[model samples]
Target: MAGHGDSFVDCGCSVVGQAGGEAAATAQRRVLARTASVCPVCLGPAPAERVAVGDAVLLVKRCPEHGEFSAPVWRGEPAFTGWVRPKIPTARRGPGTERALGCPNDCGLCPDHGQHTCTLLIEVTQRCNLRCPVCFASAGQGGGRAKGLEGLGGELGGRPGDERHEGDTRASRREDDPTLGELVARLAVLRPRAGDANIQLSGGEPTLRDDLPQLITAVRGLGYPFVQLNTNGLRLAREKGYAARLAAAGLDSVFLQFDGPDDAATARLRGLPLHADKVRAVEACAAAGLGVVLVCTVARGVNDHCLGDIVRFGLARVPVVRGAHFQPVSFFGRYEGFGAPSGASESAPGVATAGTDDRADDRKLDDLREAARITLPEVMRAVRDQTGGLIPLAHLHPPGCEHAQCSFSGTFMAHEDGRLEPAGGACCGTGGSGGAARDAGTGGMAPEPIPAALGAERARSFVRRQWRAPDPATVSADTDGARGGTLATPPRDDFERFLARAGRRFSVSGMAFQDAWTLDTERLRGCCIHVAAPDGRMVPFCAWNLTSVDGRPLHRNGAPSRTGVAGCGGLGSGEGAGA
Candidate 1:
């Protein structure tokens, strides 16, 4: 829609003649890019347009049968246009499998993909100890099915290879859990195929597996350079020796879910009041010499207000707290709005109710409503406001690995006294349309711009260093033959020298993933974070979790419908689901 007399268009007619023609000079929301999107109603491809809607941006699309739809893709100052840091698109490395269907459906990293894999997530199990109401994977203790590496391979198409089990045991395996041997076989295939991929061991809760240490050891044996565990931190808090055990097993880092600073916020997002447990978990990892990154799920009017506090807390922990990743809540499995009526309780602001038809398709353009949560830009502003302008919005690096609008990050040097000094300076792009704060002097200090050629490598290096947890027991020994020949450790004196050259650095990052409503195929093409599927396919993260408006999954697990999508079925244990 153009600003030419459309009902949705407003040229700021009231102030057009003011501000020495500044208002008159400004253009109304206009189309920026044409791309492919999915119809939230039918889950089919739709013609979409990325429009500069004032200071924010929105993705609008129309389905032949489902009418027009729109969703906010960017918000706040540093206009959407400014955040883009374009790079040369890489040529696809041949489709690993036949193109079964276009895009999303044929997610075998089909030769059409525009980005290379950076992080490969392997879901070890579908079972989770805590069932949060806003689960993207809808994981639980009793409902979902589970699969091992071999079974996962079958889902993709066929097993990687017909290799027999080597040194396997029944005690280490559960009904739905994968045997250590099966997992090793699966990774063995992925190791060389993905090429120097960073692996994250994920599950309902990776801590649930008793053989988790052995699993980590196997992945390390696969020669994966970096290995991380995604967990809720319950076990780490309760079991004083758990962190040390993981460190011994060669696990490099922990992606701990820390929603907010208060118990009320935690109860609202997670199922229980877990502030104390979260704190204890971080302390445990610190004592065990494990690095921790706090992963926060920001819900509007829920824990969104706690953004700055979370950053401060993360920085206060310094070398131990490596980073804070904020993810705005996206509607998918188990979402009923932040304060909507359900079993979970907290003194929320209010309840959000749809029309009489609770399951009405919200994808229609006429029915579009504002999401009830903070966005990436809002979080960036919060960081500036709460931190006394020490870290302004520009401090965040523009998108590099993912789509320009998908996320933002900033790296900083941390001191023991809790002072955070910007390490790489302001490393973000400015929306072509000038922003309110573009000339605000960025807290009176000029930012050092990161060169385009060095941006990606610099960002990757920082993430690698910040997220790695040094294990004293192993140092840098080659535990298995898979470790690329040999692993080397720096001497204590050498380590001190490295620390002096580059003090402890931490990243403050935010990723706003797309849900079915906002699944943009153009953005999908540039996704670098992928999940390893059983059939030897590498699926993009958002596409893997995408569910129809009615709750039928397009990839991985079959989910029950909230609006009655056909073929939807109950998820059972071992389904290999993830959040």
Candidate 2:
């Protein structure tokens, strides 16, 4: 009744839809104009054709000024518990550096993961209130103790990672247990980059610490850029203003663990119906003005059906909700009964590199692919359809990812309302590069600037406020100068690349859905760094993982054990390394 313009706008305005002008059809698509769809960035009624025909995923939008831009498909409003709301009026960048991961072969920057090891996260405790089975930290395996596993260190068996403290068990283990003030003092010695360096306080449950807020205050006093907590929402929801208290104490944001709407799935993952609790926690975080990046450990056949539901949940939270991040169950650390029979996992479709590899008991990146059983792009497509095209791959997609598409986990799609787009969607990590955007990162979108569409005010506002780094570049190199240390490059491939290759080796994919997908050659050469000093900084141009990154088997994804390898032989932070 209104006009074709109304129809285009109703479709949520493709990036090229707003500007109704001549040549507005975009040579990119107007060049193939048999029929025009809708575009927002370039204005209405633009020659915007769908990329993946039957996919129903509005992949790209053609804009005359912007050429073509990524677009997400939106579904509808989300369905989360009524109480939740956003805390921060606007989303702030979460923890971690803009350019954290590095480029393999020394592409450009100053190697050592671009930003260098400015901030290194240390998990003091692997204990938690809930036994989330999906937790790679293996909180479920513990007996609800305050620290890590009881006597048995590492996984359920084998030698503990950091056993230096193990001997301290006799006569009041105080020296081995570094207090917050003590930890901060040790951190001070690290001499993190002046203003750029940061410190993330992660654990089985950092909030579980009786003196968390106080310790956070101390960490803040250390002049850290921001302090973040990785937690499962128990104390956050129950303790009113808990998040705000930490925020005021210099806590930046929270990496909250959240799945989707499936109460059953939540129960399975958390060993309890945490759906309502998680919602309450989000609301509490919002009320506290704390930014949140919903973290989900995506597992095929587990809660995959709830992908759309997850995005919807995040979006409804509005401003406080920055975005959702997905971490396809990395088969590292302590996750026990979570993967497939083969014990491998993959990222979502189009996102996964290859399939998981056999012969790997724990943390074989290759084996993770087999476990994930999906590609990165395919997951991106699902996210787009679920979110109703509001969140595009480029907007929330990964940057320089192996594939053009990023796994839904590391990305957060933005929408006009200022709240996150596809709020309730799920997330996880993995790779894919069958040729999509081709420039997004492992946890970010392509380096390209976001289009000035949506609203001139809103668009400009976002570019100025939300964008974290101008160019999120990755720095990597061999730095072998022919140095020594079990550091052997992967034969034809170096360690980082080889590991990345292993990361994607096994997995499932395609509508045909085989057990494998494509792998990003660059990611395979896993970035390697040698901890040269006790400051927690990684030596530049170091070789990738030659023998083992952390420990092998039981202690592979080692957390700092007071008496583990981290603390053994005075090897800088040795005890802290083997959690």
Top candidate when judged by TM-score against the true structure: 1
Candidate 2, backbone clash total: 137
Return the top candidate by lDDT.
1
lDDT of model number 1: 0.61
Measured by TM-score, how close is model 1 to the native structure?
A: 0.75
Question: What C-alpha RMSD separates each model from the true structure?
Answer: 10.9, 21.5
Give candidate 2 regions above 4 Å deviation: 1-119, 140-177, 193-195, 339-372, 394-397, 400-579
Q: Give the local distance difference test score of model 2.
A: 0.38
The alpha-carbon lDDT assigned to residue 530 of candidate 1 equals 80
Error of 2 at 196 (Å): 1.0
lDDT tens digits by residue: candidate 1, 373-401:
45678777777787777676656755655
